[model samples]
Target: MNAEPVRPPAEAPTTELERADDGAAEPDATEQETAAPEPAQQELAAREQAAREQAAEPSERETAEPVPPEPSKTAEASPAESVPTQNLPRDPARASDVLVHRALPLIRSGELGLAEATLDRAWELDPRNPQAMAGYAALYVAAKDGDRALKWAKKAVRRRSRRPQYHVLYGDALQLQGDVTGARKAWTRALSLDPGNREAKARLADTSAQAAK
Candidate 1:
């Protein structure tokens, strides 16, 4: 009987440097793979990083916030602003006082013609009164008579120099007559006399705005 021949396994390929360098053997591909992750593993990591960034883009956009709008500015109001008016005298206790109470309301209500006639009756009763003089000035102001208002307002303040309300009336008359400087002085005087006078404070506030212009 005849027998068959057996062959050994083939050797791996190598170059001069791969075979030996300074008496040390170069590593085979399997040994290199065990020593460190290289080209193939690095390429796979780069592809996964790119995929993760792409997948996160839509969620990042959905979580974004919009800016809100700002509020608009408005004009500031005056500290002592109020209706143009005078405090009515205490309930009448005299003949002339009865007319003052009646006529002051008429003047406030804009009935200048009737108020003037009623004021004439009060004038005949007590012509020297500062209250009557201021009332007359206010009535003339309502009547749109700047000259008359100024005239009577001046007389009223002169008649009662210590009265803050009379000074306030004088300021109103000065403003109506286009004497802004005089009006400021009158209001300033009123404040010096009675710092808590609200109408004087209101008039001065308006005067300050006018001066700025």
Candidate 2:
């Protein structure tokens, strides 16, 4: 019994008690390193999810269907269009006659400017018309521009030699320019064209009286 002296069992290893009063246990270096990467992994996963969502979304131009262009309002003709087919083969002679008729009232009312403007428009409508040229001659006669009157009157006579009015207007211009003989000849021709022409008779009488004077 003395040789086998019993030795007390080795005291059980005692674990150190963690106190609540002290701070929580600090992680080891290896644990801290591993934990630091967890936040980065989560952030990387979040970024990847956001990228996936962005890639799935359609762009504005791609999402919207192509819209057709609206038809042009100006290009399309209206159903009730007013086409001037009546004047398609424009009769300058007829147009000038109508204009002269319209302008006569204005001339008689002493609206010389307006009459002249209307006659000018008539000339533009029918430049070669005898009536338009005669109108211009009459306007110049009224304005006391004897030279211009004679010029236009001669043109009218040349264009329409058979017109009694054209001969009469030529006689008037000649009278204004003091060409008594020429006026008498023109008025005589007018009377020959129309025997009952009062204006030609009066003009002839006046020319005869002037020659006697």
Candidate 3:
């Protein structure tokens, strides 16, 4: 026997070596499987960092003081409250004068409804008040209601015949009604009561010039 040439026990079968290599490769695969979660972990960390950043920022309400609301533009003062101390009348007799003074601008500005309401209130405050009656007469003249203007004008003169302004108002109402003679007499009476009455003087001049024409 040739001493049994044992070639290293036939060098273990090639298939057995291949099997060992395969076994070694299994551990590398397991390591690769474990490392696969690193990308997912990085994504999760990125999301957590973004959440922290957002939480660190301040909100508008938390960063600044709250602003107060502005006052309303349409807020109005009460009639009594709106009147200044100087505008308030000293007595009941002058109450209608105060009201008329306040209403004139409103009437001129085409706020006739408001002026009427104010004059009505003045009348309620002082019934048969000369100034209130005169105010109504003036308002009716502005509205082109000649009958009502004449009626209120007569009432104003009846209430206070001595007041030159009342006679002037009556004259204006009479002039609106085409009563030229009546207007002239009323205006003449106003000038007699108040010699320096510029309005009465101007009206008399106008009436006399018209009569001459």
Candidate 4:
């Protein structure tokens, strides 16, 4: 009643051959992996070396040296550090004083433009110069610029009140502005300060004559 399982001798031999073939194919794949191309590896190494060389090379700017600074004239002239002096009146005033004095003759001769040019130079040299300030004030007054004349005259008076010419100039400006009382008071103050000031005396006489009219 029971049937027995049968084994084929030919089939067993065929299964053994197939297992050997699989083993042989695994060894061939291993050989192929070991024999992979070396050219790509060499190229990668060469590129890395080239990058390192480029990083090591000096740039155009780094190789060039810096230019030295030029020597200053003042530094060469003196070894010791010098102190700056305040602008004070020169013991005997320079050509600036002469220029201011010459401007007066131009002003007297009715050459306002020439007088103004000289005074401008004199004031530039000595900014707080009384004579130059007064001369410039007078020039401005002659040019009919009362505001500038008053400004310069005030500066002149502030610089040197002993020079009564500045007060006369201020008085003249006040007179032009129709402030007769203020002009009279300024002229009176100028005369009181410098009793022998010829210009102040002349202006006071003119003011009195004009007021009487």
Ranking by lDDT: 3, 2, 1, 4
Work out the TM-score per prediction: 0.54, 0.55, 0.55, 0.52
User: If candidate 3 were superposed on the true structure by all CA atoms, what would the RMSD be?
Assistant: 7.5
Q: With candidate 4 superimposed using the best TM-score fit, by how many Å does residue 172's alpha carbon deviate from the native?
A: 1.2
Better of 2 and 3 by lDDT: 3
Give the per-residue lDDT of model 1 (tens digit) for 161-188: 9999888888888888888889889999
Instruction: Indicate the worst ten consecutive residues by lDDT in candidate 3.
Output: 78-87
Error of 4 at 117 (Å): 1.3
Q: Quick one: how many clashes does candidate 1 have?
A: 0
lDDT agreement with native, every candidate: 0.78, 0.80, 0.83, 0.76
lDDT of 2 at 17: 52
Model 4, CA-based lDDT: 0.76
Residue 103 displacement (Å), model 2: 1.5
User: Which tens-of-lDDT digit does each residue in 144-201 have in candidate 4?
Assistant: 7878888888888888876677898988877766777888788888999989988788
Clashes per model (N, Cα, C within 3 A): 0, 0, 0, 0
> Residue-wise lDDT of candidate 3 within 1-213, one digit each (tens)?
559665654465568778888777445777887766788798998999999998999978898998999998767765544443345676766776687778778778877777887887777778867778888998998898889999999998998899998899889899899998999899999999999999999999988898789
Candidate 2 pairs with clashing backbones: none
